[model samples]
Target: MNDYSKAARAADRVRIVELDAEIQELQARIRLLQLERYPCQQRLDAHRYPVLALPNEIVGEIFVHFLPLYPDTPPLTGIYSPTTLTHICSQWREIALATPKLW
Candidate 1:
């Protein structure tokens, strides 16, 4: 009976070791998959934003709304100025420059 009990404990220890190795391997595979998915996740997240999906014409119209009232020249330095729109992103910069109304 003593020998049988000892054998059973040894088998349990071996199984524990095997399970630990499998757990480690599965964890490594999960990390690899997450790394591979990161860039795709970033692209999906970017597309999810409403403003980024707007057409250039609509974005141009939105820029037009940011302008100062007539006879009041938009400041070149402050956050409310057209120059700030140019600083937002490359697309905004191009749109702001092309819109003669803002200048």
Candidate 2:
């Protein structure tokens, strides 16, 4: 009975060591996969969308579409304002400032 109990404990310890080694291997594999995915994600982000790549003239036309029909004073605050559009990017800021129709 004593020998049987000792063997059972030894088997359990061996299994625990094997499981720990497998866990470490899986974690290393996950790190490698994440490193591989980083460049692909960066490349995808580098490819600009059609709207963002549009000429400033076209972007200015789109900005003009946001204006009120009766020529009310532009809103000083909020995301809907032309000022908010300028805050998006340097190019948009230049286009918004250049287009007098937006003012």
Candidate 3:
């Protein structure tokens, strides 16, 4: 090719390399942003479920209220059973187990 065409091709190749480097930098930044977002996103989602914020004592009290009245026993395993409380989540499971009245 002519000298002008050779210079133009060389310039194009250099621009291409620069653009590829920029793309790689942007991709790395995106990955970092995603990593930072994960915990914040989890916190935001946790906030959406306000019940999880209740104190353990209050949760235990709620479980007591969930039980049948005095002298009545809840089933071993069912929707209305205290075991159902244990099945809900780790926090509730702890609360239910700690509250002697539920047993």
Clashing pairs in 2: none
- Backbone Cα, N, C clashes tallied per candidate: 0, 0, 0
Q: In terms of lDDT, which candidate is strongest?
A: 3
TM-score of each: 0.54, 0.51, 0.62
Give the better candidate number (2 or 3) by TM-score.
3
**Per-residue lDDT tens digits of candidate 2, residues 1-103?**
3666977999999999999999999999999999999999776755755556789899999998877665476675787678888998888899999999877
Model 3: residues with Cα > 4 Å off, grouped in runs: 1-31
- Go through the candidates in order and give each one's C-alpha lDDT: 0.87, 0.84, 0.90
Candidate with the larger lDDT of 1 and 2: 1
> Which residue ranges in model 2 land beyond 4 Å of their true spot?
1-4, 48-73, 77-79, 82-103
Clashing pairs in 1: none
Shift of residue 86 alpha carbon in model 3, Å: 0.9
lDDT (Cα) of model 3: 0.90
Q: Who wins the TM-score comparison?
A: 3
Q: Is candidate 1 or candidate 2 better by TM-score?
A: 1
TM-score of 1: 0.54
Residue 55 in candidate 3, Cα distance off native in Å: 0.6
Off by over 4 Å in 1: 1-39
For model 3, how does the per-residue alpha-carbon lDDT over 1-103 read when each residue is reduced to its tens digit? 4677977999999999999999999999999999999999889978987778889888899999998987888887888899999987888899899999888
